[model samples]
Target: MRQIEYFVAVAETQSFGAAAQSLAVTQPSLSKQIQALEADLGVVLFERTSRRVSLTPQGRALLPDAQRVLRQARRFRNKARSLGFDTDIRLVAGVLPSIGAYFMPRMIERLRQEMPGLKLSFVEGSSSELARQLVQGELDFVLASETDRTDLARRDLFTETLWLCSTPEDPVMQSDAPATLSDLKGRTLLTLSPEFHLNAIVARLAAQAGATLSTEYRGASLDAIRQIAANGPEVGVLPSLYALGEAIRDPHFKVRRLLGYDAEHPVVFYTRTSSPLQALNARLADIIILEKQAIRAERAPQFQV
Candidate 1:
């Protein structure tokens, strides 16, 4: 393994000294490894001179094959690490409160059906909070919205649109047209907590539309926003996943669309970069996506347009 690494490093850098600098090894040590590799393969790999060193014809032919071998070795190492994770190891997952309330059940059910002995624990918080925990390694997986993070490996699980929910009796909602931001001017708009990504989006839109975001009251979960919207004149903004679920459960739920806005969030599973659990995480992400599709299908007649 070390020989292959040394060979690829030198071949890529084209300098034993530079490769040693990058690999944090002595040049003489790197040269010794290369010599051993050449002896094992029975090939004169490089031509050495006072001013320069270059690959021989045999070295040029072997470079690509050596690179391929390095890639295979890396993949083998990753596979072995992933397999090292015990099935009974308790996996800690973080989730946004709103998503977990409705979406987690199907995921947990499916995961358990596949691995009945899998020990699992769930921690619920705002998306930003969950992301912080994930980065700190306090959680194994997190179902959250996009954040300014590049350290984690992410798989998009669901993309959901924002909906303006209100009582049908609200005078503005009596119209046949989709609700526009203009329709919200001077009206009270309920929003999720400031920590939620939706809150910031709603705040920005409210400023543009001349609407007033109810800062004194931010709904902690989508259900809280839905509850207030059910009987109040104040419009609430929430993801379509929750609105669609409510609409299907109670067809009378007042779930309306934004006239020209595609304001949305991508719910993603974020785990450690190059996580060994990625193989398992992929299966979980797929199940969440299917759940999103199932909910959309359940009430497609009203919202699909």
Candidate 2:
């Protein structure tokens, strides 16, 4: 563990003195630990210079695996500390912005009630961005709708309805009132950017409708897309949660369903195939599943699209 800690500190700081200071140890002690580690592995982990320390090619190759080991060691330390006077259990959780705004509060409250010792940190990003971060070990788990479950170990959390929203300030022609694929023929549509999950769905729908949807004012986040839709004649398709609560609250906004697309969108939580945070991730999933069950029982509409 001494060798592991020394290697990580040195790699991160790239200076022996800085690493030593960070670890609250003497420079000589840190150098000895790194030397012991290199000798045990039969590889030169780092090259020492008067000005700066640098990782050897071998060290660069081993950094990620070594970081995982160090992270696991820290998790063990936290688990041990849980039995002591220190009661905090730190965990990092990521989610797409829309769901974080709407569903997260309930799950967070339940999580706090169930695990008072746990301190959950939430990060918001596009699903693809979150997935990349999860793979890079920056996040323990992600709650998002667009992540590919086949490439990751994931659990379905909940599903929401989707809808197309436009401001009532600009009503559609009578032929387009009960909007269908044919009715969208000449209408210009404002959609979310490519980063959003619903963007692909909306694009496919437009293709089937033989309509060209312009994304010049597109945004990746649900909140931004809702705002764009609320401004004027722009039509933005969004999840039921945002369309209903934020976009619809304005009497100027009108909600319409996409003629030929799947109504239910599956939202999920994902973790890497091999992660040290499995137990913590599963605990969070249990809370999500319980909340999902309650929401489904009530049968409330999350989207009207």
Which predicted model would earn the best TM-score? 1
Per-residue lDDT of candidate 2, residues 30-91 (tens digit)? 99889889999999999988887999999999888889999998898887756322257676
Model 1 regions more than 4 Å off:
1-89, 114-119, 175-177
What does the lDDT come to for candidate 2? 0.73
| Backbone clashes in model 2, listed as residue pairs | 162-305, 163-305, 168-252, 240-303
TM-score of 1: 0.65
What value does the lDDT take at residue 125 in candidate 1?
Answer: 89
The local distance difference test score of model 1 is: 0.78
Clashing pairs in 1: none
Lowest summed lDDT across 10 adjacent residues in model 2 is found at 170-179
